[model samples]
Target: MGFLYQLGINLAALLLPVSRFFSPKMKLFVDGRKQSFAVLENQIDKNQEYIWFHVASLGEYEQGLPVMEEIKAQYPEYKLLLTFFSPSGFEIRKNNKIADITIYLPLDTKQNVKRFLDIVQPKMVFFIKYEFWPNYLYELKNRNIPTYLISGIFRKNQLFFKWYGGFYRKALQSFDHFFVQNDASAQLLKSIDFNNSTVNGDTRFDRVAQIVERAQPLDFIADFKNNTTTIVIGSSWVDDEAIYLPYLNNSENVKLIIAPHNIKEEEITRLISKIDKKTVRFTNYKTEELKNADVFIIDTIGILTQIYAYADIGYVGGAFKTGLHNILEPATYGTPVVIGPKYSKFQEAKDLVALGSCLVVHNTEELSITFNRLITDADYRNELGIKNLEFVLKNKNATKVIMDFIERNI
Candidate 1:
């Protein structure tokens, strides 16, 4: 299995240049890693002690952020080096203030792994949810580094739990500790005879809770809302817009703000053409002009958390297609969240549904009906919103829990 995994990694590294021609995202991926070693050699100071954190993408980075920040606060002497397996996370957070250095993680071949570890010389390492590179884990363990998997979620379907999974199971066992998000994950680890695990919940709840505490009123959003009930459609994709656009276009006395998952010109134009009502781009809108518009399209990123503050109801996107985006961002702001039907994989989404704090809609009609009911019934909407906020607050200490364990053990 190790040989096959190494062969696959080598194949991917060799074929990455060809993939760049077919996919722009793949192009970014290949391009980002081209100078990774050079970047490491140039930027990383061997004299400075470092704590390394690895995340697969933007979502995992957000999940691991609270713990990273707490670690930074507790050990100010240690510099932070963050790495991303995907370009989406690295590109967006390369200039982030939290880490002293940020770079794309090199491909997980033994040679590359050794080179990266030697350069960073991380005192401790953290792998965020769902990122398990066997080679890297093996190398870290060989060096006797204290490595942890934070906010880990495992399912029976994963290779680690399968009959022929001994090689993969070794990767799981490499972690000094597994701070899992739920009981099922802990049980899965235990089933594999890996007892170094704890159910510490998810650190994203802590991050979002911080966002809610620091949330301030956005003057432009306030002016645009104009005291009317507002529905924020955050991180919407084409499929999500297909289901909810018509209802938003025809609805009256309520404002809709869309922050599409992609902000490319073509996508923005396509969304605008679908909307029947007068629409204004966030970048182009004036405060006085907002009253005449029924739809507002956000052309920028990084403000979705703050946007949730002005939302009476939130429709998080992505569940209509691949999966669900972050519903907790809206829930943290005491807003009732609604998403599409395909959110079974997300534990928080399932828990929110079970708590009656989140509503699931299958199509345009279901979304319209759900929205109409929530918009008309203020008491019911507020009740659900309060429940969502409480749910977030109740799960707020996962970061502290993980940090406490790290302090004691590492």
Candidate 2:
């Protein structure tokens, strides 16, 4: 199975140019590879010890960030090489100041992986969440470079737990240690006779905690909100918009800042057309005019984190679909969160709901009712918000735990 996987990877690399022509994202990957090696060489010298962190996309990047910052603080002598498997992560964060170098991980063919390892020669490697490339793992193990998986989660349905997934299981066993998100993941790994794991929770908790302590007031937003309650709709998808449209139309004395997942012009145009209340795109509004618009559509990227700081209530999107966006960002700000019904897979989401910090709704009507209750019932809102904030505060320091383990072992 491992051999076949490797063969497929090699085939993919060989045909990547063809794939690039068909897919927009693959084109970015091809373009990214052009400078990857140069970027690596620029930061990594033969004398310097380098640590490599690989994340699949933006969400995993956030999960791995606290640990990355810790490693930099503790081991200032070590160079950092950060790699992303997806363009969404690499493109947005390629110029991140913290990492000595940032680039897309080369295709996991034997040749590409060998070249990548040879150039950087990382002292240690960390894989965040779900990005496990078997060839990359095999090569790392062969080189005796320590590797760890941070904030990992597992399910019984994964290949590692299947009858014909011995190679996948072996690939996972290559990790020196696994700092998983919950006990379920630890137990699942142990079921397969893999025991070098710890339930350290998600490092994202630590990230969010740090965000809260350093939370700066958004003056522009504060002025816009004036004394009115504000609902922050974060990372909203089309499905989320359907449920939120009614609220936007009927609600008054409540400001709304909608930060959609895709802020392309077409999407923004469609949003403006559907909204019944006074609506303005963030890009178009001047500071003076911003105070009057009931709906502020965030037509740009990178402000979602800070926007949460101004939220009285938060509605995180992607729950309507199978995978969900980050809910902890808003929860860390001490805001009650509302989402669709598909949150069972996320341990934090389930825990938040149990702690009374979140409301789960299955459809538009339920969502409307929940929104009205959270807004009208001040005491209820404060109670839920306090619980959520406390939950975030308690779960911090995950990065410290993982870093301590890695520092000693490496």
Off by over 4 Å in 2: none
Give the best candidate by TM-score. Answer: 1
| Weakest 10 consecutive residues of candidate 1 by summed lDDT | 283-292
lDDT of 2 by residue, 388-410 (tens): 99999899889988978876776
Error of 1 at 88 (Å): 1.8
Listed per candidate, the RMSD to the true structure in angstroms reads: 0.9, 1.5
Instruction: Show model 1 residue runs off by greater than 4 Å.
Output: none
How much lDDT does each candidate structure score? 0.91, 0.88
Candidate 2 backbone clash number: 0
Give the per-residue lDDT of model 1 (tens digit) for 92-117: 88889999888888899888999999
